[model samples]
Target: MPTSYVKRILDAQIYDLVVRTPIDEAPQLSLRLGNRVLLKREDLQPIFSFKLRGAYNKMLSLGKAELAKGVIAASAGNHAQGLAMAAQKIGAKATIVMPTTTPQIKVNAVKALGAKVILQGDSYDEASDYAQRLVIEKEMTYIHPFDDPEVIAGQGTIAMEILQQVPERLDAVFIAVGGGGLCAGMAAYIKTVRPEIKVIAVEAEDSACLDAAMKAGRRVRLKNVGIFADGTAVAQIGKETFRILKDTVDEVITVSVDEICASIKDTFDDTRSICEPAGALGLAGLKKYVGRTGAKEQTLLAVECGANINFDRLRYISERTEIGEKREAILAVTIPEEPGSFKAFCASLNKRNITEFNYRMGGASQAHIFVGVQVVSDDDRYNLVADLGDKGYPVVDMTDNEIAKLHIRHMVGGRAKEATDEMIFTFEFPERPGALMKFLTRLGDRWNISMFHYRNHGSADGKVLAGLQIPRKDRKKAHVFLDDLEYSWAEETENPAYQFFLS
Candidate 1:
């Protein structure tokens, strides 16, 4: 079917019902991509999303009798708020079914809109199933999050707004795909009006329903969905929406979670608004596509669809953003377990500030240490590995290792030990430029250092673990030196490994 019917309906009412979101020229992004890039600021909408446009359009299209019977919807979050707000405005009852795992902030937001919230199942699919059942039982109209023709037509209004706002013709428009509703609707309208402009759909690699569906030539269920981008963590694309997107979208791209986080931070740098990971998918695709094709002088648009990010999650996003950009490297180093061995290892490092260090005595022979370093470019990584190898200490780069990335970053070795003349001390000091030098200088000749470990946890304060080998008779003198030290230190002299290995 021709998009003319949807276009006609949009012209008649959607243009007025939906807010005309801004399409600002992004100079920073343009310089990065070597293209004239524009951003559609749908994130600034009243509901902080483009979802309101579709939900309002769908509700407004229903007849008086249908509206009187009320509406039911299942959403991860944004859609529920959209439908609830629209229904309240139109004097219609609304019931929203959301997954039990949905964030409390989103659940409370829907409740604030006067919708009766029902928490069901673990995922959107399960909530959807419950909503479907409620629809049949209560005889309420089911307002799908992204499937109906009305919702699709409403979302297409974004294209109309983009065309009106950007004077120059666009080479392509990138939209984040969840159930394909936004892409299907926007592509249908834009392709019909501006056939030369290409429509691209972007999805999270971990939750790429449209990409998989296109590959299989039919819609297929995903075995697992990534929760990082909860807004687009869909298991399957909508049937009707997929039909429209299959032919309309020129390309589908899948981006990693880290890529999406980088894009989110990039958008924040440009606009200072925190965009949810799903909302940043379009920008991520723009970066990847522009790099791959090396296409310049072309006009491009990315939809900033939503900005409803959880405040608590911002810390994690910020921490990972630089890492995602390859601006930091984490490594595991195996150094000689002998006197002055650590001092020699420190001398081998090329003066780059040590970001983190952690070490624990594995046995009587050797120690395993974790280290983090900052780097400027990809070539710096090879140089670092070669430099360590040249120093006779081989390093295992954990920058790309999944297990090390997630768990090992926070864990420090604490193996069992037996007590002997060997004593373990924990020291805390202000992590400054020359703090390590002062500590080492203070205890220079008083004791023989048997083992040591230090790791900076992205903090200004420093914590160090040291193992000292001393004669049992000299314990009294060792206590006097430790007590006179300026820094805070604790003695773990009766440790099991101290007796078993050090003795």
Candidate 2:
């Protein structure tokens, strides 16, 4: 009864490198959603990710002569570590070409696995190119991060385990898609074994290669991809992966960074374990699906795919979780510059917890204050905003505003002195030694920095608010600097919060 892909999955040689991760029910998340949400604990694997299964299967499939030649791969992080560990198992040598900009934790992990590490370009694309060249030159066996038959077959084994583990009829299964390896494998197996179950794929909104491919009915490349969910960030889906995913995958949903942060929190509360954004992506998509469709009580399984989280990322996850979960509302209120107004605003809060309040007494007639307050639900946020507006208070809901969340919340002070022709931008300073220095070095010495504020959230990325003097004549230079910076950035020069306060 098994298809060729399912038969391949059954024959995969992976148990030597992978543990049979557990599938457990998420009681807390289930209670809240009025559905039984089951979690496949792939994060519990020895490498803290499911990549080991595919990596090992692929490497072991090579002939003794091929294995003697060594293995080479290009990965942002997880796949590199997985391949290195796989090589160690088979007594084969491996060379991993990784992005130089990868977090130190991931880079060190691969080195510890006895793989030769080569830090190459700023992205996976560049690193893969370098690896491809080396594959031909060294005659090494190239282990692709995804898109290989052995890797897909190996990943499909997870579906076999899931079928045996889940007792009830599963309504749906949500999986996070990167280069489409995991999703393609799981969907293929599930579609054959349990055709009744729905297979949904999740992706980071900024790097939705599969979503684009599905929309266009062919593989399409994205010019840019978001690195926030670094493990799942791929510019395009692989050719073979797209061929299978188009036919087998049911639906694909894309989630935002904030939503991913919230999903990480949800996993923590349910399992007391934190997952990286890409790891928590399936849960994020499941939540969105439930909310959007107003789904009733149903049996759902979300793959807890990987837990290779950089410890520093917790602060950013915690900070964004509140907004992502709709438990907190940020408001910019225009209060009169008169006394007793502050007390009045406090009184209007109606016993809710005040998470943040920033007021600097901007000027004579009026003062603007940025505030964050706890709320029970989305309706609570709407009601609070309405109440404030009814009281003749001009308010702007900063909850879903990108400019407000990233920049305004941090820039809660006065304007710089005579800072003319100043262009402001928010950037993520990656966590690594000399990274800040590298950023500064790239910024030419000609432009004067008018204002700078940085808040380290103890994560892989530090939030930085930069105001630079880019006069009309030098505006082109600023654009060039940003283009070459190789960092995630958002321009805030035209944000409402900037006009209300910093400007």
Candidate 3:
């Protein structure tokens, strides 16, 4: 089975539309990480993603009649563009059923490539179901984004190119996994050809289907999938992809959204090219690997897979990069509400550059301060907190608090005295037209909204933090309503950020 992939990879005739992507060195990252960091620049593909390789290969494998019958697929973004381009090149019709939550740039790209774009459902699974119906009705050939042998072999070409390009000894090849096609294809080829090399599969923490499947020894669907890295936001791993990957991959590394953001910044610093969150996923895992294992001077490569990010999302990504790199510490410190207390707290900081500072008088005796300070490392952050504690100031480290970073930081105001029995909740919903209205409508007039904050991060999902006035007697009812809402919601009533700044 493994040797079959080697032949399929060799026979993959993708050079017609795919290029031999370059493997460039990341000088600054290499120096900082103390490892020879190399980037497989698959972002430079004709469609700005390696998805084209698999798409074109699968199309080319079809008979003349099949090609003439047209092809259909469900994709978040990259695969749609790849399939559209492939169909255009081969003079066949293509229909791409994409989630309504997909970025406008991707939708426009598919249309520009002469593909019929149909906006469906809020997630890939929903769109995929819609695509299957269309496939039957239109009698078109369904081109799966992953799972097919031709598609897997096509992605394996990247592994083939890596072996040929990097003649030097390599420690590992890091690949990002969605449905597992990319990792399975690459891992099968690499393991069979070079057994000594490690094939590392990187996944976003919110959407690690392959990791879940491997642990269970069977594929299991995730209850909820995060779309921050929309390209890799798959709920379940493909049967074919999981079979190949379970045997070939050496390790699986899952990364946070902030870590992915930091890698995007890392890629931009070295190559002067912006990578989407999923594109930079492999590099994020590579950095974590080096930091944890203390691997040094060894050659490691990460696939920089795509650059199809929305320009507006850069600000949100940039804001979180500092925290991801462990260079910023966000804390909630309590001090006496007296004349000299503020000055004393500042002096205790030892003139460190303060990134953010928020103060509000909570009572006659105490004041809560929400602050962000520049830190060199995680140790430095702890030392700063310890020093503040020694100076008679109570501190709560909020650097890793999702609610604090996303919403509480922006809404750091003293609590409203009238807002009694307030329950805080964070919800994630598809960022489509009338989405907010629909969410509010679901709640109806049952609970009064005391505090609310929403910010669009230019991704598929919209994050909202809301405080509602719900009495203890109606708590069970409120939870029942939330559970039936079908949105990813978390009760943040006990969040320290809310208690320190708002309550």
Candidate 4:
């Protein structure tokens, strides 16, 4: 009677092609929120995304003559790979035009799948323009990534799978929306099959086209889309997908980039699977909603749609993960400029260890020290702040401050110079009992410490700064032994201050 029934049939026909991706119960998430949580692992698809399900289905539905003409599509990454792989399997010629800035890994993958890869402009819109021109010039059938009914129908299969996998009727399902294809398809089918179930579409706050369109009661184009989550960075929603999503989707919510990063880390900790920022959008939305609405009893499902992360980007993800989760705090502490003053500040740290400490001369009386501390929980951060307050120390919490996180951490240590052969090394060490003593014992009397500084600034671990004076003749040998020190040390010998002061 409804389009959901048709969706179910289509899903059945493509069941062999589509992976029966796991709908694992997220016990950690469930216990933390006191709610039942299910994670739909569409990220495990053969193409590393659920886009393959829709792309393949769309190509398979094409008429014989249409297939002969071949297909052209535009995408930044995931969809391009999906369409290319789908077209290859169906023996249809496919041309995938992607932005020039698209990751090389994705470009090579599409080419490996026997698709003609075209590098176009800097963004998806420019690539799409080039793709449309090719479609007209080559007389190829242009496959709309999200707007077409057939494509939407294919994406709708995910909803059918979700219903089949989860035993209980979900109170709400969070779908990450980009051009509205996934959300439109899932919402159209889910609302038809289970009218009482809420369909929430999640989008990055920086690029929330559906949210803007819904507010205006029509399609709205965003001036700029955030590139943090490349998979879901759409400036505009498709015409057909918008039509379906407008009525079917219960709510469209936006989340910050930090929230998405936090969820990605959470997913890794829970499942050991690294989801890209876009893939973690559904989980971010679920967490936001649960925190805001306090819907602890609601049965919630989060669709993890893809896991195509660039290997290099993991460093940035890892760096921001703790701050995103509020587990790490960066603080700027002002302490009196005196020899014993450093020890007094360390004593004030109480039980907290110093993760990082950098001291720079602010004035004659006080030193501006940047410190990093690890907190057991979010509430522990408040406790640390209160402790600092009681100690009469001026502390500025830069935990969520973006500029401080990036520029301040490395520049906190004071300016100093050592001899030409001396090397300034920075080390991060655990702040346990006898750790500092062990470090001092290891250095011994062989290396003259030109500049030695250490501060325990309320972090879980401590950071040490040392300038080792090595003879010009022994520089190479000293470097070799330092490498074997087996500590997190970086050579700052090339730094300008080392040239001017140490040299």
Candidate 5:
């Protein structure tokens, strides 16, 4: 009986707890992208997320018997908060199961909403399993984050609001995808009512569930997903959402962490708001589409989805925004170790603003200098590289290299001249206390520590670069050690940056 998506959307129970957000024009972003940018201010919702609309709709639709039995749901953050608050409004007991690795800020926020918070495993799947088990034992209704029809219809209201508010001609609407609720709901409604307008979806390159689904013509689970955009770090799209997406969504695009950070800055400049990485995804995709198609003076809309983020994460976002915007260039160049070589390198820069410079002594002939320079455009970086190359300076572009940005820049000096048969590895781990100590404990005390580099990125995880001195004959043992560590890592023994300076 509820199969009519359009009728279900129109008849859905919502608006008591959810606000009809404004569609405001983003001046700064519009100027930058050469398109009239409009933002669907879903971040201004009561819960600071669009999740509330669907959560409340699903909760309100349940009969009195279901409400009396209570409700339970598993989420990394936003959905849990939304469901908890909705249950409170509906006078029902609520329980939320969250990953142990969820940020303290989000966990605290949900707890403050008067929900029973249960910390489960390290991922959403593990937490979800725990919650599902509780539903049977407690006889409670389970509120799904994105898979249910009532929930999708509730989110569809946002599309209805956008069409009513922004009646002007629109070229596209950009939506961010986690389990594909927002995209699926909006795309379905938009394509149904206004099929001429493009419905585009964006996702973090590291956590692209919707993209994976469209590729295989079915849902495909990802082996690993990045945690930077934790809100959308879903490993796979929902069955119901994917079903809707396949019919309505036009394209799925992936954006890097840096691009997401840059888009966050753009959002702040235009609306004076700071959005989480998942929140900025829509804007990031809109910019990418403009760049790819060279589209101009067209009306484009992006859903400013959520504002729940750790305040400390601003530092990491600010640091990478410049690179994302292509305003800064980080490079590795070989220069003579002589005194004048340093001055010559500076002269060749033509007095461009140097954002950073790190040098470590190399072999007798030359040293490698890791430099960061500010430029107005990408072409400026190319010209700088050409000029340095013409002057006989060997240069490598590290502007887009993850290793250089995350690890090598923080490590200015690390050499193992006397330590023979040394091997280096970079690792990423949860940033809790004693995490690094735990990692070291796993490595064992058998091999001597040759080099170590680590620093706080002020995000969810900590990065570490470590070197161990072991004989070539024991390389197989080292491989066995790495497999046991169970942390995300890569060996840099053959990396040129290590070879030129750290070796």
Candidate 6:
């Protein structure tokens, strides 16, 4: 059944342009997880991504007439560069339509390859629509990033290489899924050749089209997808890829942005190479799988698929790595507003490293302090919280609180007494030109914005924590207005972090 793909993968004429990436053993990760972990270093490809293999292979299939007509595609970044280079090598003009929010690095890389770059829309789906229209208007062939059979076959070559490189038995192979091409290709080949080897498909929790599809027993579209892992932030699985993945994939694992950050750190520790969020996704799932299954001494492989991340994003990724690895705990603790209360709280911490401390005077009786503590394990974090509570310091763990980690930790302060009837909401929207102003414009002047906090994480999405003074009588109407804004948001008025720090 899968021999067709195997044949195509073997015959893919990509070696001239695509490098055979090496597989490296991750000694640190293996020792830490108690499992033999291997990394397929696709990040070392000439384009610093595995995308070139597929793009070049697909271009090679084109006849001279089609090549003369030129080619077009929509990509967030990596695939655009790959296709641009492939088209240039084949002497075909290439046009790339990329999302406006795509990192400037990728935009420049594609332009450097002599491709016509058009920035349109804020998401991949929207840019794809524009690319399709251009393809029709310009009479150019559209090279799909992950949906085509040629593309899938090209990606399958990675699996074939992995099998050939690893002489030892592998219990499982973790593959990252965007529109499911890589997973579908690898899983089909793996199952066909070595049916006993498990194929685990990893996806970002916020962009888990495959997980959603698997649950529904059909492909499903997501209303919104987080773009931290922009390479994999696809809203839906591709039709052909899904057809193969539905049956071939043995399991699906969804990881959080923080977990992905932690995996990037882990990859760096072992490989000394930085990985983009999507590149580290498979490793994140492998870590999660090891944690859940506790299958010690087992051999596993994960694909590091890309390294096209913007340098500026490292700050945000570094900030979240500690928490992602369960090495840091953020908490809100209430102690007496007395002079020695600080010392007493410190004593209760059992000398654990304090990563952060944010404090502001509250009322005369109690003081709310935002503190970050280094921890060894989840149990250690729980014990620290218990110890604080036992010492009569009322504590609320903000470690898993999204608002706390994203916004509150940086802007913690006393309550806003004058900002009455304030409704706080956390929002995420595309990070593009005038996006913030556009959001504010849509919010309108009906209610005063009492509090606002925003930080750029160098991803395609921008996050905002806004507080608006909406009277109780008009809250339902205010909600209606927010819904009409069409941005992904959630009410944070009841969040404990907000209650302790900003309410």
Best by lDDT: 3
**Model 2 weakest 10-residue run by lDDT:** 454-463
Candidate 4, poorest ten consecutive residues by summed lDDT:
494-503
Model 5 agreement with the true structure over 1-503: per-residue lDDT tens digits: 21367777888768778899998889977887788999999989877899998999999889999988889999989998899889889888889999877877789989999999999877788889999999999888999999998889888899989988878798899999998888888888888888899999999999999999899999999998887888888999999899889888889989999999999999999899899888999999999899889999999999999999888889889989999988999998999878799888988888898999898786688889989999987898899899889999999888887768877887766665598878888888876668778878877888998888887765657888888898999989888878778888888888776665577
Q: Report the error of model 3 at residue 21, Å.
A: 1.2
For model 1, residues 302-363, the per-residue Cα lDDT tens digits are 99999877676676677667666556777778787888877777777767777777776765
Clashing pairs in 2: 312-458, 312-459
Question: Measured by TM-score, how close is model 1 to the native structure?
Answer: 0.78
Off by over 4 Å in 4: 1-12, 376-383, 413-503
Q: Which stretches of candidate 1 lie over 4 Å from their true place?
A: 5-9, 15-17, 338-353, 363-366, 376-383, 416-503
Local accuracy of candidate 6 as per-residue lDDT tens digits, 1-503: 66678888888888888999999999999999999999999999988999998899899999998988899999999999999999989899999999999999899999999999999998999999999999889899999999999989989999989888885799999999999888888887888888789999999999999999999999999988889999998999999999999888889999998999999999999999999999999999999999999889999999999999999899999999999999999999998999899998888888888999999887899999999999988899999899888878899998999899989998888477899989999888888778888988887899898999998888788899999999999999888888988898889899999999888
Candidate 2 lDDT at 289 equals 94
Q: Where is model 5 poorest over a 10-residue stretch in terms of lDDT?
A: 1-10
Each candidate's clash count: 15, 2, 0, 5, 0, 0
What tens-digit string does per-residue lDDT give for candidate 3 at 1-503? 67889999999988978999999999999999999999999999978999999999999999999988889999999999999999999999999999999989899999999999999999999999999999889899999999999999999999999999987799999999999889989999999999899999999999999999989999999998999999999999999999899999999999999999999999999999999999999999999999889999999999999988899899899999999999999999988889998788888889988899888677889888889999988999999999888878899999999999999889887589999999999998999889989988887878899999998888789899999999999999999999999888999999999988897
Model 1's lDDT to the true fold? 0.79
Query: Comparing 5 and 6 by lDDT, which wins?
Result: 6
Listed per candidate, the RMSD to the true structure in angstroms reads 13.1, 2.1, 1.1, 12.5, 1.8, 1.2
Off by over 4 Å in 2: 427-432, 455-463, 472-490
Residue pairs in collision within model 6: none
TM-score of each: 0.78, 0.95, 0.98, 0.78, 0.96, 0.98
5 against 6, candidate with superior TM-score: 6
Show where candidate 5 strays beyond 4 Å.
Answer: 1-3, 363-365
Error of 4 at 380 (Å): 4.6
> Model 3 — TM-score against the truth?
0.98
